[model samples]
Target: MGLSKRNRWRTLVTASVVFSLVVMATGIALANITLWMHANPTFVSGTEKLISNFEKENPQIKVELVVFPYPDLAKKVLTGILTGDVPDVYQGWGMWFIPYIRTGKVSPVPSWVTTAEELEEKFQPSSLGAYYYKGKYYGISAETNFWRGGLHVNLDILEQAGLTIPETWAEIISSGKKLTKRDSDGYIIRAGLTWINQDNSNSQFLAGIMQNGGNYWDEQGYVKLNTPEAVKSLSFYRDLVLKHEITSLTIDMSAEVHEVYFKRLAAMLIRPGWVVSIIKAQYPDLRSAFVALPSIGPEPPYYPAETGWGYQVPAAASHKEEAWKFVKFATLDKGASRAWLTEAFLLPALKSLEDDPELLEAEKLVKVAFSQLKYGRYVGDMGSRERFTQIIFNISQEVFTQKTVVKDAVAKMEKEINEMLKEYR
Candidate 1:
């Protein structure tokens, strides 16, 4: 009786093991992977289509997408990090992932997932570099934006004034003078140039410094803001209002709030290339053009290209393999990639998509933006982007208000940034 019982137990254990292997082979045991993204209707639509196709191709896998509001998305991600409950995949701004990467919870893209040759041949260097650190790449770029050197022109306003698109800074000022309109009280009824907010101001400042042959980052990636170039950049913006008189302090032409650019209250707005998408979607009927800002110095114009946002798999994820599969599919699959680019109104990070004839022909503005990518200088690899941006914003406001002169403001900026970098050093 004891021998019979032993045989039966062995048979039962063997059968159970076989059944588990069969389930694994059929992909029945692991079928779902989770993804997190910020809320945007166009983005959500694009993702939904991509997921649908991904699921069709891999019938055994299902994707569960979790959308959060823009402001709350980072908070939710932080909570997930603390609790070790991260989604299988997370899509976020490239720079925003820097902190998480240092925590060691973000998985580096495996060699099997993407070969080095494909990585180099397919994607933009700056776009891919956003997720690179210490010789490891952590994510794939979904979208990119060159925030420097784009001068957005309201063609209707330009046409009414009988002026063509201004190429150089000298032309910008001269044309701005002609475009400015004043009321009976000498208050600005229309602004010839609109700076809008700190975001645009900071971008223009970086461009200005580069134009004047100055760099915000040195060879060792340390902050270098206390220079003549920095002061000159800040002064230029100040002069736009006080010295040049093209921009007015009272004109509330904020892009988000007033949209004075679209309303024809502003003739020209200095903005990033990606803003063209917003213009196309929101004001399709409004005639507009985006031209590269001509070189201010003898050297070529340098643009700050940031890897906007992309997808990554978490180290703590339950289904990392499935998650990576989705990430690869989302970023590399041609049809899905095209759909995402079109729906999201994003600039292409892939080399193949850069010259998509249909996309270029349909959106002439995008073509102009793409042509400017040759001058792109990748600035997304640094961890100090937010802190540096804040300092620039603060100094720009002070200078514009005349509470602080350009020299003092640049000195303050350099001091604050270097002080912040001490911790990293």
Candidate 2:
């Protein structure tokens, strides 16, 4: 009977151990969270390190990163929402989030993740633009993205041309004339200023208008692109090709403008802070400096800007609490936030980190970009920013080709964009 009692006790102990193992396995299984982001080389490496650290801290949790190509990410998330198969967490663009918010696919960040007051206190009000919608906050601000403000100067080229950095619109034009190099056949061997690339032209154009005291959006919050300011903006860019003869549309139309700048075919390219990483990583020998764009108008320059990228939880998220833990860790935690900004070459969205000595020392260009934040103009009310951008590009092409006049080009842009806005409105 004693032997029998001993065997029974052993069996009970074994069962208890098995049950504990099962419970632990279940906890881990439920803790798995998926994060989605665009596949940007700059953002990926840092994200991997953060994920590893996050998993270590929360042993019960695991994170799987889902990367889509940069251009395809917006569509992928929108489709995922329709299918109710979105990731637990994802990186969101400021203007792109409007559709997700309208669809109710993204959740308002719960108080547990971050209180509204805490968010306001920790982040610069402008940096939080992307995550806020009509009366609701959706995510944590991760980066401050200034789309087209920094004028990246090739120092070697400028010094060779015997000119300093351009400080005003007139100076830029004059410098362009002096710096442009043409071959025997009158083909431009090197460009003075390269600004009309597909990726950035719209923002630059809009900045031109805003700088000239034009409003892209009317008082009623609809797109208003056909103003005199817009016409002047387009005319100036066109003259850069036809009148000034500094840069050619053919070269810019065929290749990436950044590549043109990198190859030394273009002396200056309008870029954002992130290019500091690309330059340091790819072209270490290239002598470069980033400065605020030369004043574009009689008034102070206006920069068309937006929230760069941030983290958000989907309303359809399965592991919300776990997801928020990762979000809070990645964004609000000082070490992780600093690591991300440093690795990704992004500007700080947090006020505290804006002047952090270590960060400033690491990324000196960030200070120049940060100083221009006062002139940042956000068009948060656009019905469809993607469509708006496409229209601007189309108008640019038409105006440059002389297929349409500047006034006609902007008018066409205005009409097409307003039509697209109807659906969102």
Candidate 3:
């Protein structure tokens, strides 16, 4: 009986060893997916939940999320790609990733995406088109932003001045003059209207150019910054600072223009809808309203500058299949997308979710913004988008600082832009 008991104990020990080995093997087989995205409270929380749900369904896969500040994200991604330490999936601005796509470093959608048309059908045309290059897609849009300029008014200031919301450009200028206040020393106590010169100069210029029926590129892809329409647009913008003196040239670059408005230093600011959330969060007691900026030249074909961010997989990623699975879950899955919309307050790329309950509720607060999207123009698809925007900003700065006349500035801008384009040609 003692010999029998010894044999039984040995059998139990062997079984325990076998079970532990199987558990270890399973752990080794599980794919670890790493994703890099801009760090935001909503994004971090929503993505954490997504990973939890995904892992539950996919027992053989584990996901790791990495977050970085918005400004630092591009540099980090470039470094990762060069060092072969890139994430399985990365979220980036469309313009920044376009160059990578050209270099064949960003992978096209998986083989499952058989055709461009199939992919296009899944997203808004303009949003998806941002990631399209040379008849191929390198990324998928998760959120689309229609960043049209809108007049953000301080209701308290307007009420104090007994002024109504401006309906036209003339009215805007007139109201600006009325609302501007100065001390006896000629120092501006409050600016009537302000534009975020440092951050949004390019977007403001582009919107004005498009509204005046100007094209940034010709049929042959030549820069047209010196066209008559462009001159009118730049001159109008310049006059807002120098000629009309509606705003002050002495700006606090450290703070965003919206922050200036929130501090009650500015009565009006022309910016995108994102400011609504910023105001609601930081200055909840401040009364603010957003109205669509009136079209510059009234005829037809008015357009507004648009920009967005999306997800792309690097070609060098070791787990493309697993990466694609996560991408689809984050962007295309209904529950995941809803969570993002509710948490992040971003516009949905998927057409079906346009009327989603969460989006519907959010839309009520940004009615003007929703209306503006119809006129939105995607700026990312343009070749050399980053270079073009920088040149535009430089030209605007020259005009604002009184360094160059609008005519001369446009001419210099056109020349510089063409020089950049020659490389692509």
Q: Which candidate comes out best when scored by lDDT?
A: 2
- Write candidate 3's Cα lDDT for 75-113 as tens digits: 798777777789999877766776667776878887573
Higher-scoring candidate on lDDT, 2 or 3: 2
Candidate 3 regions with alpha-carbon error over 4 angstroms:
1-29, 40-60, 111-115, 252-254, 299-301, 304-307, 380-384
* TM-score of each model, in listed order: 0.86, 0.89, 0.86
Candidate number with greatest TM-score: 2
Clashes of each: 0, 0, 0
Q: Global lDDT of each model?
A: 0.77, 0.80, 0.75
Misplaced by over 4 Å in model 2 are: 1-30
> Order the candidates by lDDT, highest first — what do you get?
2, 1, 3
Better of 2 and 3 by TM-score: 2
Worst 10 residues of 1 by lDDT: 249-258
| Ten residues in sequence with the least summed lDDT for candidate 2 | 22-31
Models sorted by TM-score, best on top? 2, 1, 3
Error of 2 at 156 (Å): 2.2
Better of 1 and 2 by lDDT: 2
